[model samples]
Target: MKKSTLALISLLIVLCLLFVWAQNKILNYRTWFRVEEKILMISDRPEITKIAAMGFDGLVADLLWIRGIQYFGGNFSTLDKPEKRSGMMNLLRNLVGLDPHFLAAYQFGGFIINESIKDHEQAIDFLLDGADNNPLTEYPSAWRLPFDAGFIAFYQLKDHDVAKELFLQSIYGKKFAAVSVENAEGVKDDDSPEWLIDGDPFSSTRFDTSDGVFSLNLHDERQVGRVTVQQDSKRPKSYQLSYAADASMAAWQTLESVTNPGFYFHDFEPALKAHAFRFDQFKIQAEEDEEFSIAEVKIFGPRNPATPSYVERMAYEMDRAAGRFKAALDQYMRYYDEAVKKGDQVSADLSLQKLFDIYTNKCIEILQETAELYLQEKGSLPTAQMFELIQEGYLSRIIQQKITEEPGFVEDVAPVLMPTGNVWEILTTWDQKDPHLLITYTNDLGEEDWYITSRTRLIAEQKGVAEKLQQFVNKYKEEKGTLPENLSDLLNEPWFGATRIYEDPMGGEFFINRETGQVEARNPKY
Candidate 1:
């Protein structure tokens, strides 16, 4: 009887779950159907499953509009027409309007439409529509679509200040309460003289922007010179450490004696503020002692990508958010003015506040959200670029893995710049013969050099070097009576003394084997 009761209870539970699932399925199907209907209203007006078949060229209209894909010429030679790309933008916007949370579509659509329309102003319609749709995730991808579109405004569109402002604004979405506490003064030894917090916090002895580029303060008294700036306080992601020599000059020199990322000290009598260097960059440190004299060590500034100060990056992000908001607001205000003039009072007033509130809330939300993201993504603070890449599906582990795969090669080939368009341009080159000349760009800075395949080709090009060696061997035999066993003996000869058998540029050395000449260099693997 007990078994029977248990079986009956199990059946009831199963039936109940099935009923609930069925109800949920019906509700979801109904909701999706409505959305589907809305989508059809925009594109497939007749709501038919099948459209006229397209052959050879897929969607003739799309072919004409797209940029890279050919539309005409009956062949693949011509670039894709821009008109098809515009149609794609419209299609993507319609797709996004139906389901706003389709994040990849925004990226894909942005890539094509941004280029197709050529009018960046109109191209944003699809992406903005996508940005407004929320699919509901902890990190709402909808928030990111506008950013991808905004790049069109900045880069492809060539409205630089606008692009920059948008990029800066994109880094922010959540708010971060930038918390900071003033440094506590260390207790001095009784034997030492008392000291006061001297000069402008940002003056010669100590330069504290307080926003975390760097803090430089000098302590002085007697012959003992010790300048203690903030050490390990934090480092910006892409900053260089240096100090100014004076106010009038606009240059800063690298602190050579310093070993760590954020501290410096020197043997000068009393480390005072450098009153000379004022600007940011300086030449490499030479052996000159006075040039490296100690005064103050500045942590990298806000502009420095390496700046790790939470307070500073947060502030920079906020300032950028505010700037973008102001501009957007101004545009909104203009629209509002026109609406009011046209007697559309409801829209004029509502639109005005809506724009302001969006910008204001955005400013607050992003500032707060950044601090946490920085700690989560970087463990400390993030650089401007790091902040941008991390939020966009990029993982730090992948970046580290890529960096590690090349061994020290990543550092050796770290590019100063890469090409970008609406998307970005990547040049993939393969060189099996001459590696030295196989560099991506032929013209290079004086410092940049090739180490791998290019080096091997350079070795291959060295010709007369071997011939020169053979000639020397013959001459040695004639002069020294018999061939010398080693090159040292031949060095005494006039020709040997004056002419070299090795190529310095190619790093090739010639050796004689059985009266024959041989040229060799270190292989690429080495």
Candidate 2:
């Protein structure tokens, strides 16, 4: 081989080595910059940052976000630090400003702002801004931004009115649809009767005077069974029920006569075969008032497919009451899935509440029962093994089994914000006195997650303690033939085998008000 060719090959090897060394030096320099303990101070002006990014604004914002997460994760500093939290918030705000369509950024950032920073106000602001800017075209039909805003309002701020309004807007968006009325434009004021289709029995529309006409238009004709009238206060002296084919004709067919008022069920003879009906004219003859108020007017036929079968709901309640937690949960799950599949948000919400009640209320009863049995048999407070046994065999089993089932179980467990129309106005009132329901929504790569609220867990523990205390009171009354003045009396009784009342699992003191027979927890942090 020629010496010149050998030298050329050696020179090629040298060039390759030089390239490798240069690449390693560049990587080492970048790593040094990445690890340096530099203070992170975010720009307050998002607009300025956007302008500086030029055409690659979104890409720049995303790169910054990745860097922020890495930095936040690397630093083991306390999240409670004001500066750290402020810097993170500022970073998130800028990222959102650059690309409002970045959903994951909003979700994760809101969670951190609320949980780590504990700045619920700023978190809510972030959610509202995202909701206003990113339309439904970019997200799910049930946009989560408003839903998150509602969560902050109710869970953190305890402002139900604001939460309710936010929830309604999230569900219905801008346009509202009528639930009962088919074509509202066709109905002329007082001339047309208010149609009450298949809805809640308790819901009703007022009928002005006893001597007034109420027209009815059935969606389909069927074998008529009975029409029930629910009055507001006073029952009319006498009322007549009639049916007609159309509004143009005057001759009405009498269904039945209701002499006494209150909830009058008028049954039709031979089952009238007509599509339209009317109150035809009636009188109250009340002493003081000239007009009578009717809460609801329900028209029941042979079989109305719209009406929910109470048999299933009642069966669930019965099974739950009988300590059949697994069966009851299964029943509730069935109804919940059915309602959600049909897009009946009202029924879905109702079934979801029932499921919650069983979990937080009925399940606690079983826990208390287990505790009572352990005390009776072992003559002491329950051990950790006993508690674990109850939890595994009962509580966890029921929930885990359902969660492991079909694909849509997770979504069904998490109630989506859907339009409820008239039901919204009726059910949206703030019931501050009742125990609040908290729902947390999260998505990881399109997989939804639902969890039992912390408040529910706390309430369940309290209810367990309260129920056991009630049993003690009842036993005292049985032995002494009278209610005790205080819980100390039960503890003092020797024959009662009274040990000590169980301490609240969620750090708090339970007290019974002797005057009211009411048990409540004091300083309940949960």
Candidate 3:
């Protein structure tokens, strides 16, 4: 063999050995790294992290997101530790900070913080930050963040006021207008009820009888909130407020009863939707041949241009969320059947329990809303029978009416309550003015189980009452050419007639803001 050929072969052999050694070293390093647990260390300052990203924030965010998922999964059992939770949150913040449009990361981080870490305030703040970062005009899916925040506030924190605000934010635009009024029961004459809604609070509608009725009609079904009634000298002794969805005036649901009525203003939380409202059972303190009159009847509701599309969007998002859960439930049921066929009892049990959870949650969501309406109307939680009445058809009718009246609702079948064997039990004590519903059901374990649903009714009753009082103050000033020395002076007037002028629902005192001459609550609920 030639010496040159031998030298070339030796060189080739050396090169092959070097390549094999390098490959083995690389494989060993990867194996060692995989075995060792890695810690997720991130900068506390998002701005610093964003600066370091060098316009590759999106790519960095993606990589960090994957690392976050792995870290969360691996340390799932230890997430209860405050340090671990903090680390996870920091990583999430940095990831989102680098890429503000990383909506999935925001949502996932919120869920983990809420469900695993049980840090409600942080979760809310994080989710709201996501909502603020993504404007609804630019990213329509941004609504989900606020909706999720509302869910956390309502369900976890039990802060209905905050939840209501968040829910409103999620829905975006909701503008109210004055609802139209007409004479429904009173004698038809020139002094018709139509004059009550003529924009002039002084334009009077005279009724000859002690008892009279007026109807409020809206162009479209709207979520009616504020209703202000101004009396012309002779106020009714009392009145009943009710609503109906049709012109027939059948199936009217009573909203409220005012025992001592004068000038009244009420703002309903979680406003009720209907086509018409009725001021019935108006009993005036009348002497013989004396007539009472109503100066104005103002009903405020969401009837503006933006309301229709916003409302539709809200309903659609809610239904979409429900649909996702339903799809998951259907899949679980299928898996349960498969598990049963395979005789995998444990898997079947797990699937069945999951199905029950999803079903119960969805039912509670619907029931909670209906129960709230009942509470708003009756001023108390529904009894079993009352709840049954609502479940049977009343709620369905209200929903159907709303859907039918909406401009773009064209579904063949209106959503209705599905029949379930679960029983609703109302639990309350003598001291518990606001009670809750306990739903009893047989779970997958074939045992009696219950889920409790409760919520606080955050109504600004005093706010409305104070505004009405301020109106009275303005009237008193207009009449006497001076403000009353005290609220007591106005109560002494014959038109008011010793009727309790203002009582705060949350145990606050109504006081006059002497500077602005506006009535204010000492401890405002809102």
> What are the lDDT scores of the predictions, listed in order?
0.39, 0.56, 0.63
lDDT of 2 at 104: 74
Instruction: Estimate, for each residue in 165-206, the C-alpha lDDT of model 2 and write its tens digit.
Output: 455345323211121332222223443234344344344444
Tens digit per residue, CA lDDT, model 1, 1-526: 6999999999999999999999999987654332222212235421221133223223432332332232211212211334333334445544444434556656666655555445466657666655445321233434456456556765566564455434433433211112111221222223110111221222222122222222232221111122333222212112244545554334667644333222222323233345321112212222432111112332211121221223222222332344444334434555566567779787677665555344334322332344345457766533322333335533333334545784432322222111221111111111112221222212236453322223343443555465566677777777767766765556677667654334434443444454443323343221
Q: Which candidate is the best by TM-score?
A: 2
Query: Considering summed lDDT, which 10 consecutive residues are worst modelled in model 3?
Result: 408-417
- Candidate 1 Cα misplacement greater than 4 A, ranges: 1-87, 134-138, 142-146, 174-526
Residues forming the 10-long window of minimal summed lDDT in candidate 1: 421-430
Regions more than 4 Å wrong, model 3: 1-41, 173-526
Evaluate residue 419 in candidate 3 and report its C-alpha lDDT on the 0 to 100 scale: 28
Please report the candidate that would top lDDT against the real structure. Answer: 3
The candidate with the higher TM-score, 1 or 2, is 2
> Cα lDDT for residue 157, model 2?
88
Error of 1 at 487 (Å): 17
